[model samples]
Target: RRYEQRIAAAARRAADRWAGYARTGDQIDLGAEMRHFALDTIWRALTGHPLDQATERELDRIATVVAALPQLPDGEQAGAAVAEDLARIDAVAHAAIAAARRHEDGPDGPGVLRVLLDAAELHPEYTERLIRDELVTLLVAGHETTATTLTWLYLLLDREPGARRWALDAGPEGSPERREAVQALVSETLRLYPSAWILPRHALTEDTLAGHRVEAGTDLLVCPYLTHRDPALWPDPERFDPARFGPGGSRPAHLGGYLPFGLGARACLGTQFALRESVAVLELLLPAFTVRFLDRPAGAVYSITVRPDGPTPVVLAAAV
Candidate 1:
C-alpha cells in the first residue's frame, strides 16, 4: 500500500509538471518528457526520492549505450565505445547506493534500494557492486519501455485523430469506461510498436516448431513486432485500430498471436506498472490537452528497442 501511494505521488508530480508546460503553451520534446516522467516514477520506487535533473542528465548515457549496442563489436570494442557513458552511469549508481546505505529514507519512504541494503546486512552476497547493478538494471528497464510506448501512443493518436475522440467519448473522466478506452489505445499502440520487439531464446534440446525441426543449442529470435502484425493473426495488420481491443472487438484467440510484452513466465515484470502509469498520464492529459506536433519523426529506429527515428517536437494546447 505504501509503495503504491509513493508511485501515485510520483506520477502526480509528473502530471503536474507537464500541466505547467501545457498551460503556458510550451514547446516540449514529447519523447523526452515521457522519459522524464517514467524515470521519475521508477526513481521514486528505487530510492524513495524524486529524480533530480542532474541524475536524469547523467542517466541519458543509458540511451546512448543502448542505441550503440547493436552495431558495436563485442567485448573490448563495445566497452571502449560506451566506456565514458558507462562510467557516468556507474558513478550515478554508486552515489545512489551510498546514499541508500546511509539509511536515510527519501520524502516518500524507504525504497527498493533501502530494502536491498537491509538485506546486505545479513547476506554477504549483496555487495555494493551487485546493488549498483540492480539499481542500473531497474533504471534501464523501468523507464525505456514505458517511455517508448507512451511516445508511440501519442504518435499513433496523431495519425488516427478519431481514435482520441472515441476514447474520450467512452465515458466521463475517471470513469471505468473511459479508463478502459484509454487502455485500449495503449494496447493497440503497443501492437504496432512494441518496445521490446525481439526476444531471443536458446534451444535446450532438439524440437520441432510448426513442422520444422530445431536442433539443441540453436538460437532463435521471437519477434513480437512481427507476430503482432502477422496477417493471419491480425486483420488489416497495418491499420491503427484501437477498436481491436475495445468491447465486442474481434481478435485472435491464441496467446502467441498478440504478445506486445512477450509471453509466459518470463514476460515483462513491469507490465502492470507500465499500463497503470501510461493510463494515469493519459487520463489527465487526454481530457485536458491536445498535442500538435511541430515536426514528427521520419520513421522507426530498429535497435536495442524500436523507437521513433527522430525528434518528437510538439506544442501543447488546451483541449477544445
Candidate 2:
C-alpha cells in the first residue's frame, strides 16, 4: 500500500509536467522527466524532503555516470573509473542521510533508508557510510531499471495501436486489473528489450544446462534477450504479443528463460517497485498523450545497464 501511494503521487506529478509541456507542444525529454519524478518520489518517501532543482541535477549526473561506466574499456581502467563514480555517489548519499537524521526522530516508515537508519541505531557498528552505500544501491538499482523499462514501454506502445487499446481498456493505474494488463505489457517489453540482457554467474558446483557441461569454477553467461525469443520457448517470439501472457495464450514452460531481473535470491530486490512504477507512469501518460518513437532503431548500448545509444528521441502529442 505504501508503494502504491508513492507511485500514485509520482504519477500525479508526471501528469502535471506533461500537461504544462503539452500546452506548448514541446518535446519533453522523458529520460529527464522520469528521473525527476523518481528522484522526488524517493526523496519524499525516503527522506521526507522534496527534491530541489539542484538535487535533481545531481541525480541526473549520478544517472549519467552510471549509464556511462559500462561503455568504458574493460580491465583495471574500468575498475578505477567505476570506483571514482561510486565514491561520488557515496558522498552524495551520505549527505542525504546526514540531512535526514538531523530531523528524523525515529524510523516508522516505508522508505528503505528509514528502515536502515532504525537498524543503524541498534547496530552502532554499522557505520553511516555503510548505510549510505546500501541506500545508494537501492536508489540507483531501483530507479535505473524502472526508467529504462518505461522508456521501452512507451517506445513500443506508441507504435502498436492494438497494444495501446488493450493497455487503455485495462486502465494502467489505480486499477488492479489494468495494472495486471500493464504488467503483461511490461513483461513482454522486458522480454524483448531487457535492461540487463546479459547476466553473468559463477558455478557453485559442476552442473549442466541444456546438455552443456560446465566445470566447478567456470563462468556462465545467459542472455535473456535470446532466451526470451527462443522459438522452442516462445512461438512466433519476435511478435510483440502481450496475450502470450493471457489466460488462454501460450507461454514457455521454462521459468528462468524470461528473467529480466535475473533469477534466484540474487535477483533484483526492486523488481516489483520498477514494474509498478512503469505501470503507473504509463497509466497517467497514455491517457493524456499520443506517444510514438522517432523513425530509427535506438540501438541498445550496454553500460552498467542497457539504454539507448542516445536520448530515446520520441514525440508525445496531446491526445485529442
TM-score of each: 0.94, 0.88
Each model's Cα RMSD: 2.0, 3.1
Please, what are the lDDT tens digits per residue for candidate 2 over residues 226-283?
8888988888887888777654767777787679999997988777777777777777
Residues 1-320, candidate 1, lDDT per residue (tens digit)? Answer: 44576667766776787778878988899999898888888888889888888999999888888888577657896678698899999999898888887867789878989888888899999888888888898899988989999999999999999999999999999899999999999999999999999998889999999998999999999999999999998999999999999999889999888888888778888788888888887888788878899999989998879999999999987788
Best by lDDT: 1
Where's the lowest-lDDT run of ten residues in candidate 2?
103-112
| Alpha carbon lDDT of each predicted model | 0.88, 0.73
Displacement of the residue 276 alpha carbon in candidate 1, Å: 1.0
* Residue 121 C-alpha lDDT in model 1: 92
Q: Scored by Cα lDDT, where does model 1 land?
A: 0.88
Candidate 1 segments exceeding 4 Å error:
73-81
Please give the lDDT score at residue 150 for candidate 1. 93
Error of 1 at 164 (Å): 1.2
